[model samples]
Target: MKKIRNFCIIAHIDHGKSTLADRLLEFTKTVSQREMQAQLLDNMDLERERGITIKSHAIQMNYVYKGEEYILNLIDTPGHVDFSYEVSRSIAACEGALLLVDASQGTEAQTISNLYLAINHDLVIIPVLNKIDLPGAMPEEIKDEMVDLLGCDRGDIIPASGKEGIGIEDILNAIVERIPAPVGNPDGPLQALIFDSVFNSYRGIEVIFRVKNGSIRKGDKVKFMATGKEYIADEIGTLGLQQIPKQVVECGDVGYLISGIKVAKEVKVGDTFTHIDRPASEAIVGFSEVKPMVFAGIYPVDTSEFEELREAMEKLQLNDAALVWEPETSAALGFGFRCGFLGMLHMEIVQERLEREFDMTVITTVPSVQFRVLTTKEKLLNISAPSEMPEPNFIKYIEEPYINAQIITKSDYIGPILNLCMDKRGILKNQIYLTAERVELQFLIPLAEVVFDFFDKLKTISRGYASLDYELAGYQESDMVKLDVMLNGEAVDALSAIVHRSKSYEWGKKLCEKLRELIPRQMFEIAIQAAIGQKIIARETVKAMRKDVLAKCYGGDISRKRKLLEKQKKGKKRMRQVGSVEIPQEAFMAVLKIN
Candidate 1:
């Protein structure tokens, strides 16, 4: 155990976390040159295409120092704010973290947030300045920033360039010298924490965990503390270039276990595993269930494929444990699932994977944040969708979720950012000038406001220089109302939204106009109305494709023309009553583009 070092890499998006990870792997020769590629740990094609890390990957490496061989377990974590849960899980399984900062961009919002997470875990922090080879690189300036943020000595920060392979050996040496090895009683009771899992069609669910207190061998009877279920360890191995089968994975080692369990929900991430013969005293500490901030409905285009969609979600959930969902049905969109995601990006990724991976065409409704509702009878309820809202007479008050949002950018863009937040009904909490040119602004904004297009707008106004990081700050009572869209008098529940009273009318008006442009014309006129309770807030009409009944009787007398027009009018009124509008898929997605 003295020779085993467990650590992970932490940084902001577009930073050198994945790039540095590649250099470390290359220097250690854990992966051959022929198999090496950019962002080697990022295995998903979507990740490669977007140049972002969506999942945390773990691998084992060997290094020899001073004529002694040492085993190193490195976990590469994602840098995006939406995937912070992945970073938290990775931090839980490590003893140290390499805080990589961009020498040119300095420390951003996500960098500060991820640093706090590592500090809370009491992990050893090794600061490294990456991209020193770039023309805009400012190693000295970033080193000073790191010193201020981490409170470490000047010499403690390593200056390197991931693209140029500089300081790779220095980083490896720091890991062997600074980071402490895992400490546990190998002969004690079996205790392990499952951090992640993946599903395989042929083998079953593969659970990846780190052993802390005892040894686990092949064919051992393991028991999960959370589920209180027992299963035989069909196969156990360490994660390397492949699943390297071992006779026994000792304490303080990370490895994968296959139990032949087919069900995905049976094995929960963050659950502890122990031997049935000798169980641990309690579960692992500092691990809690993830709370999703954004909720949306995902339904298949074909209603009959509901069962298949459910199965696809289950398998996807096994890989992304942060995703939480429950079966739900909608009047506008038949049977579907109400999925809770960490953020909009996480929701988007899930929807794309469902279509690309499972080959299931799906339609997603408007995204919303969970609200707290109190009724006249003093009953408190959690409403995730507008359909779950209680009637106006039965409700006492509604409280929406808010977040503590932090934006780090240049001082010149502060005015526009403040205006954007204010327009969203946000309150400026605090502001500080980190440097002469860089400023950090904090605001308390409703989660619903940021769920739409706040991030994109901020990026645009700031010229892509601003970075945002946020956390749920709790709930606050607000003037909120439910906005519903009706097609020809019948309410479409899927298009409903719970918005602030001040903006409900404008939001409804915009949605109606957007829908008018997307909904195709039918045989009869269609009335698209946006209403709040009994009052219509906004309305638009799609005129029917008219045929000239008077064209055939142009040469007839005035009385004959009047008679043909009367007959056509009666037929049109009857058709309007029986005809139903078939809303295209684009109309459902168009609600998001409404400014």
Candidate 2:
């Protein structure tokens, strides 16, 4: 099947990879125009809600250009840097990649990184300049940049608007001409890469793969090319979202398989699968392990939802292996899970999916970096969530993870962007002019310091013109402490925090104000204090209610009292109650919220 060509689309955020995938599905008549949904590959509700690809997706299309039916497997990868590991795994599944560069935006860092990964994989690279129909699309300029930077022909630019279905046929033609077809012994040992997988109650785990050689069929005994774990292929099919049972998945074909696999970890991404008859000696380790660079706690507002939260995480983790979670107990939150994720966006996506798909509400702790803590006694503890951090005095040395970032923007906005980066405790590494009007600034910044609201702050300061790219740097020893927040002598788990010594006053004062905004008038005065070590650095007062006496039950309506109590009870679930009134989650969140 060496004559078969396989490829996927790679692009930056908002560069229209999914938009183009939808158009291709329609253009090739794989899915009818009537059913064409914009960003259709974003099948998960979370992806649609967030407007980003959190996981990779593959769809096979049988197109007849002449009299011959050619099978085209289109792999769609996530564009964000957080999912960089995922992008490379998807790249490993195919023989070629379609590099989509925004016509107006030119080549950003990710375009460069992904292009480099594809090149390293030895895949045939076809550069497509997308969004050409929109204004500010400097197609020629972008094309020139691609040739100069990527070493591709100037005429290789397939200018197309995936939204408007322009130059699509040419894209398909390029796939046929430029990308070499899948080739190997179709009769040899079966080797396929598990690029992505999903779980179904009825089917267990459904794994997707690009057949590198030989064929896969139902009832065939297969082993994980990497783990050497064996399972009988109960069924082999194509993923049209659900399994479409097919007779055989020959080499060069992209299909989904069910091995009745119960555990998600065994059939890991980049793990190869082969028949036992001609099992490969070693499993392919084409993909890298996904490690969560950021950690937080996901506590259900109502503790009863803990199991449901775990279930939701299980389902979500099937698609996103990078999202990590485990059972954890907090004095304030009772039973909850400590979740580790790639970044802030990843954390948000998980929460959104849990809320939307599973219909559960969760309170998340402030984002924290995993610190390799060295205690005065030489103990090692990997601390992430603020509440889980060791006592300030016990920590002899603390090392925090940092990232090297590239910020590209207009020349006029460089100063403000640089200023904002420094404000986040960033160390400027270098600055260079990418073009006459644009500049790129490099910085080494602690991941935790910039996790929560940095992107929003960046957009606000740069007028949404700057594009930032970050890759993890080595960890460094830093002085840090967890600042506990107390409201009327009760510790708020959500308000507990990790902070720098010098910014305690500022952070605490700002947190006190934020707590005030979150805490409503109560029956008793609430004293909110932010303290580092043993000293209180900031305080706020929420005076006892003057009028909420509810002086009278008012009506003969007992229902009104019940409704009021029920609503108040629900809100109190997220808040700690003192005497007869309740506090809020913000009181906890405020410990970290700075002015």
Candidate 3:
């Protein structure tokens, strides 16, 4: 490879990675008059809706700097910490990363995390200041911070305005000059590393990989190193969206080739692909595993749509590898998926996507942390969903998951933020203040504590001025129980959580009623009670179904009566069918609402 450059653009959620990608596409003339879109790589509606890049999109562009053509494999990686695993994996596919700091907002928590990730990988780090054209633009000051934090020379910092299309060529030159060209054997037997793979009904599986040591031709037999599965490459190509056929997706280049494989997980992200005769280096990943900290049960509000719910989850999991699911049987809710997510954001995104994309309504359980407990008979169990927990009396000891969180915010917010954290059973770790008003507070909080309402609480307390990032600290042996919510003497599976002993009563008072309001008015006065064995600490009432059951169902006309009955049935079916009462999705989401 003569002049190859592989790098990913990293920034905070709204610091303009996609905007920069759009300018690059326009600068290189990659899209003609008829092919232009504002954010070309952000092809998904959700990506544009959130104003954040969700997936790591890659595009190849040719830039001529002074007369030399350098191949720029530009990777736009997701910036949210919820997708940190994806960021790490995407960074692994590159030799360098462009650190995009918001000139106005300075360095965010995610910028620090991404910078640390790139440094940990020993990849060349190039700092660039983005959004310089904004009202609060402070490129020089931000550049100084970058020089101090990232150890970059003053002149090395590139001032850019992705919105204004300023300094695009300079960034291009810096990429070619600063980032080293990828090196790998191009003549050996075909071996490619799969960064991502997607399933298509027509194409079967579109495998995205960086060819490392060999060239893969169309119809070549290749084996996935991790799974020892081999398949014939139906077609070899690179994706700038549409397929470019007959192109050799060689070393230092990112491309998507097709294989007649249907299982999505078989050729997982970070798996290595090579010819059956001789494969490339075995697959290696920077991250050991993707651990989903937040787990919930997703059930259909209309119980008859069980198949629709399953299909919705399957389609949702295709684009999100962090999402894990399997059929979960709940005595109260029948059958549903025990879905796992990286965090609350990941969970919400999945639920919203299922509703918006699949057009299916679902009732989601309050998110919970995994627990480890032992029965009196000495049988150890790992409990994910609340239904998996052992009977209350038969349990000996329980260790619930915990995460150490660090919040960085202005000094003005310390009092309120600390109060919010402490109320959630956060053990005050320590606090340190920097030169400016910025402060960092560390807390050891139960994973179940901050698992659901943490972010929203922070936003409300600080008026959206604080930034938080947390990783799983560890699981400690403690008194953990599956607090169950009983509606009219019957347990509702979606209202359970792994709560600590001390805070159960308080959380139950707030959460049980929350679940009641979430459950619509039922036929009879339903008592929503959170109980531990025979003890009930908190209670609420789901008032008798009064507003519903329209009088029109009894109209004298036979045909009109039939239509009225059908409509009433349709509306009632939207509510939960716990024993008998229907539960609407709006009611399901209301349980999780912080307000």
Candidate 4:
């Protein structure tokens, strides 16, 4: 127990957290030179391609420091704001964290947010300045900021370049020396916290957990406190670069347990595991289930593949507990699953994974935040999709989720960025100057406003110099209405959007214009109109396709040409009266990209 060190790496995206993990793995020789890969901890292909960590990974290492063998358990965490919950869970499982900051970029929005989370978890933070090899490195300034933020001595801050393998030894020593060993009773009843879990078709549910008290063995009967399900531990092991079976995993040790549960839904993140014979009196506290904030309906391109989509989502939910979904039907898109996610990026990653990993073609509706609707009879309901919303007459007022957003950028671009926020209906909360050159602006904005193109617009205005972080601030009342798009005088519910009354006209007009460009022309004229209830706010006309009906009559009489023209005109008018427009899938997707 004295030789065990548990810690994790936390930083903003692209801040060398993954790289430092790789260096640590290399230094400890967890993987030989021939077996090592870049971003070793980021096992997902999407993570490697995007240069971001999407999942939290834990690996145990054997390190020798000053002729003493040390047992090091390192957990690498995602740096994106969407996975902040994952970060919190990872911190809860560790005793300390390596707060890695990019020496060139200094601290970012996510850096501050993650630091606060670690502080809340009561984890000892060891500040490390990374990427010192970059030409624009500012080590002294960053050290000063760390001292101010952490109130730690300047000598405690380790300066290293993760990419260049500088100061790797110093970091390893700091972890063993500064970070305290896990404190728990080995003689007490068994209690372990499930930080994460994954489903295996052959082995069933494999759970990764940190043993808090006593020990677990292969034959131990483990009970999940939340689910009250007991299963004989078929296997127990620790994670190196791969799973290595172990006879026993004692207190303060991180390891995997195969519980013989076949379904993914049986195991959940943040659940407590205890020995069935000597179960703890109470489950561990501070284990909160992840609640998804963003909602979108995902439908298979082929209706027949609905079952495959369902299976895919079930398998996905095994690893992603933050994801929530249920069967739903759409009048426009047929059967699909209305899924909830943490944020837009998380939603995108799941969609991409389904398409790429599951080999299924899917169509996703425009993302929406859950809305609280009050009916005329005072019935409260939660609306996850626009199609789920009741008619305007059936409801009283609707409340939309809002977020407390923080934007950090240079002072010169403050004007444009603030104007952009205002356009997104942002209400100013507070502003602070982090330094003479950098300003942090805080706002309370509707989650719907930021879910679309607000982040891209902020980047555009700030020339890619700004960073953003936000947290849910609960629901707020607004003059919001559902703006529906009508094609050939029929409402397309999939194209419907919720907009503020003040900007409904602009959004409707813009949506109409974008749809007109995306939707192909048909045999008959197509009228594309945007409506708020019965009132049409904007409209665009897609002219009918013209055919040379008279071209077939070469050198014909004037009467013949006139008759042909009249007949063609009459046919077009009839077609316009009875023909229903077929909206292409591209048009549905195009509306989502409309800003």
Top candidate (TM-score): 1
Give the Å error, residue 111, model 4.
0.9
Query: Can you write out model 3's per-residue Cα lDDT over 90-118, one digit (the tens) per residue?
Result: 78888898899888777767788788888
Task: Identify the runs in model 1 with alpha carbons over 4 angstroms from their true place.
Answer: none
What lDDT is reached at residue 316 by model 2? 78
| Residue 126's lDDT in candidate 2 | 89
Write the residue-wise lDDT of candidate 4 on 271-346 in tens digits.
Answer: 8999988998887664566878788889999999999999889888877777899999988889999999988889
lDDT against the true structure, per candidate, is 0.93, 0.80, 0.78, 0.89
Q: lDDT, candidate 2, residue 583?
A: 55
Residue-level lDDT for 110 in candidate 2: 77
Candidate 2 to truth, TM = 0.90
Whole-model lDDT, candidate 2? 0.80
What root-mean-square deviation over C-alphas does model 1 reach?
1.0
Best by lDDT: 1
How much is the lDDT of residue 408 in candidate 4?
Answer: 87
The lDDT-based order of candidates, best leading, equals 1, 4, 2, 3
lDDT of 1 by residue, 1-595 (tens): 9999999999999888889989988988999999999999999999999999999999999998888999999999998899999999999999999999999999999999999999999999999999999999888888989999999999999888889999988988899999999989999999999999999999999999999999999999999999998999999999987889998999999999998989888989999999999999998874667999899999999999999999999999999999999999998889999999998889999998999899999999999999999999999999999999999889999999999999999999999999999999999999999999999999999999999899999999999999999998999999999999999999999999999999999999999999999999998899999999999999999999878878777575899988887987888899999999998989988878998
TM-score for candidate 1, residues paired by index: 0.99
For model 4, which pairs clash?
none
